[model samples]
Every structure is written in structure tokens, then in C-alpha cells.
Target: MIDSHIHADTRPFEDFEAMAVSGIREAVTCAHDPLEMLSSDVVMAHFRRILKVDPHRAALNGLKLHTALGVHPRAIPHDYMKVLEELPELLSDPSVVAVGEIGLDSGSETEMNVFIEQLRIADETDRRVIVHTPRSGKEEITPLIADLLSQHIDERRAVIEHVNMDVIPLLIESDFMLGLTVQPEKLTPQEAVQILKEYGTDRFVLNSDMSSSPSDPLSVPRTVHRMRISGFGEGDIMRVSEKNIRKFLKIKN
Candidate 1:
């Protein structure tokens, strides 16, 4: 089984290692460095040298936690133009499988600059992107990315993560995919069911988006289980769980 996005914070690497030790195949590790809110304080917090996150590490030790590198929206500061300028070398690291959790946040102007810059970085590095967008009235961000990714058709592909009703049209028009993270309690099974019904299953992928939320049910595997109850067939479920993620990440699972 696979969980699309995994973080080492709430569930640290040792725990990740143990899970991989048990039977899991693989997972992708991402860190939360939201650039949108990256005030001067947050700027100081990012590991400027993100490539060296863990040089002592190798996929061999456990379930092989691959990495997706990017300066998240909440971490973008006034001087972010400088950071974006340096992202190419950081993304070139061998451990980077994708460039993500990076995208627009309606939250601030700083975030917008970072998003556009990150889009540029995605283009220059010739890598796939994993988008993270907030739920707000402004759904245009998704399509903006589609247009951006479309420009680099031969070199880049993208997946917009954590979408809602506003994102459906964007999903249909573009070649990119939509992500549906599992949050059973927050949405009530009925609301989730209605959402699944409103947006039929094709091109819809699932991710845990697991961060501080550690309730066992909110984990990646559990997200799959909830989708199953919502009536998604095995083929549909596997496509979201494995195929879509694999295609976007450009890796074999």
C-alpha cells in the first residue's frame, strides 16, 4: 500500500521506518515550509540547503521515503525573489522526485510571488509538480497552473492537491489531476459522499496530506478505506492511490 504524501514531523522517520519495515512499499516525504506566510521569522526557519535534509539517509533503511522539494507558500518572505533564484540547485538533488506542495494561496501577496516563482522553477528544472491550494472562492489558481504546466508540456506535468468543489471544472479542462485528501470527521461521511457523487471518479486522486493530524483514521491508508466505503471500485481506488501518484512523481512504486 502507498500513502501519497508523508511528512517526517507528526510521524517521524523512525516511525516511518517501522511502518516500511512492516510491509509498505514506498512513500514520499515533504516538509512544511509554507511560503505564503513566510514572514521574516519563517524565512529564517527554512533549511536554505534543503537538499541536505538527511545525507546519511538512503531508501534502503526502511520504506524508502523519497522527497518532493519546494519552498511552500507560507514560507515566502519579502526577499523570496532571492530564494526562488536559488531553487534550481536545491531541486537538482538526487533525492528530489518532484517539485511540490507548492502553489498559490489566496492568503497574501508574498504567497503569490512565491507561487509564480515556483511555477518558473518547475519549468526550469524540468520536473513534475505537486500543487497545494487552499479552499477559497478563488479557484482560478488551479487553472493558472494548468496553463503554466501546459506551456512546458514536454518537460513538466502537474497535480493540484487538496481540492474542493471549485476545482472540478479545472480538473476536466486540464490534463492535470485533482487530489482529494481524507478527512472523515471534518466532512461527515454524507458530505463526502455527496462530493464524490457530484464529481465522478475519473482523474480524482487521493492523498492523506498527513501533517499534525495523527488520528489513525486520518492516515493515508485510512483515506483509501473511506473512499472504498463511498463506493469507489478497486480499479478506481487503485488509480488514485497508485497510478496517478506514480505518473505525477515519475517513479515506479
Candidate 2:
């Protein structure tokens, strides 16, 4: 199975191995700006390692990795445009799939600028975009992002992430793809199954969105299992967990 959105670079090696053992065949790993404690080079190298297909845990565990390069909205730096300027070169690499995890956090002007600029880059490069929306205030911010992206991005090339019940309708109104992150304190595996039950497969994609939290990296696989037991046949689970994402990214299994 493919976990469409995961911060695998930020996860421990053991987690990658464990995820592989649990049937994660591929993951779309995204890069974030360095925290105040770390240097930007360190963050860049993390994405580079995945792009290089480092003979590290990801490869050793039989997990194929693809990457997305962008400044995570919450991590935007003072010189955020520098990050934007460097994106074209990174997106030029075939290993990178999208310009992503880029969108509003607090809905600040700076965050919105970074988001719009990245949208332009994605449009110019004809690359897929993965947008991040806040867990709270999604109703207020989703429309703003939808408006900005409507002007600058190809709706079909973008996938909005971390979506929940309230924001689901908002995303559905747009032509863009939607992702459900099955992580702790976010959307649970059962909730995802229920959502698929109600929403049907369509353009929906499921992800672990696994990060530094105690979130389950095996959430995608677990959700698939629960979905199967819930009388959702293999085709239904496949459409949500794999097919939808493959169609969005134009990737082969």
C-alpha cells in the first residue's frame, strides 16, 4: 500500500522499517523548513536523502520513496522567498512529486504569500501541489486558500491535506483532490472508514501524516483492514488508499 503523505524524513529509522513490515510500499515524504534549533541545510539534506533513495532504512526496508519540496507554512522563515527561489531547481528533479505541505497555518499574510508563491511555482513547473490546512479554523481559512489557489493553481493538480469533517465539504466544492490523514488526535482509522462509507471513494486519498507525534505510522494499513472488515470490498479500499492517489500524482503502482 502507499501512504500518500508522510514526513518520513523526520521519523526514526525503526519507524520506517516497521512501516515497511506493516505493508507500506511507498510514501510521499515532504520537507519542512528547519526549526530554530536546526539549520536549513539539515532540512534540505533530509529531502535530498530521500531523493537520492538513500540505501538507508527506506531502501533497506523495501520501501520506495518519493518527495515533495517546500517550506511548511508553519515553518516559514524570515527569508521565505529564498526557499521559494530554490524550489524550481528541486522540482526539476524527477524524484520530487509535488510542491507541498504549503498553505495556511494562522492565516497570516506571510504564510499566505508563501502559499501563493509556491502555487505559482507549481503551476509554472506543471508539478502537483499538496496544500496544508489548519486543524482549527479550517472553515475560515479553507475559503481563503481555495480563492488563492483558484487564481494561481490548476485545481486538478493540487491535493489539500489534513482535512476533517467540517472542511471536507469545502474541499469537495473545489475540483482539487482531498486527503484524510489517519493519525492520533486527528482523524482516526475508524473515522476514515466511516468517511469512506459516507463519501464513497471518488477523489479521496488516505495518509498517515506520521510525524514526531505518537501517531501510528501503520494507520493506513490498519484503516484498510478496518475498511475490509466493515464490508468495504477490496475495490473500495483500493480506490481510497491507492488508486485515488496514483491518479492524482499520475504514478504507477
Top TM-score model:
2
Q: Which portions of model 1 miss their true places by more than 4 Å?
A: 13-24, 34-61, 136-156, 184-202, 213-218, 227-232
Question: Candidate 1 on 77-160: residue-level lDDT in tens?
Answer: 667666666668867777787777777666466665566677777777787777777655447666665554566543227777
**CA lDDT of every candidate:** 0.61, 0.81
lDDT winner among the candidates? Answer: 2
User: At residue 227, what lDDT does model 1 achieve?
Assistant: 70
Candidate 2 residue-wise lDDT at 185? 83
Q: Mind giving the per-residue lDDT tens digits that candidate 2 earns over 159-218?
A: 988888887877776788889999988898889888888878887899998877667889
Model 1: residue 234 alpha-carbon error in angstroms? 3.2
Q: How much is the lDDT of residue 27 in candidate 1?
A: 66
> Against the hidden reference, what TM-scores do the models get?
0.75, 0.93
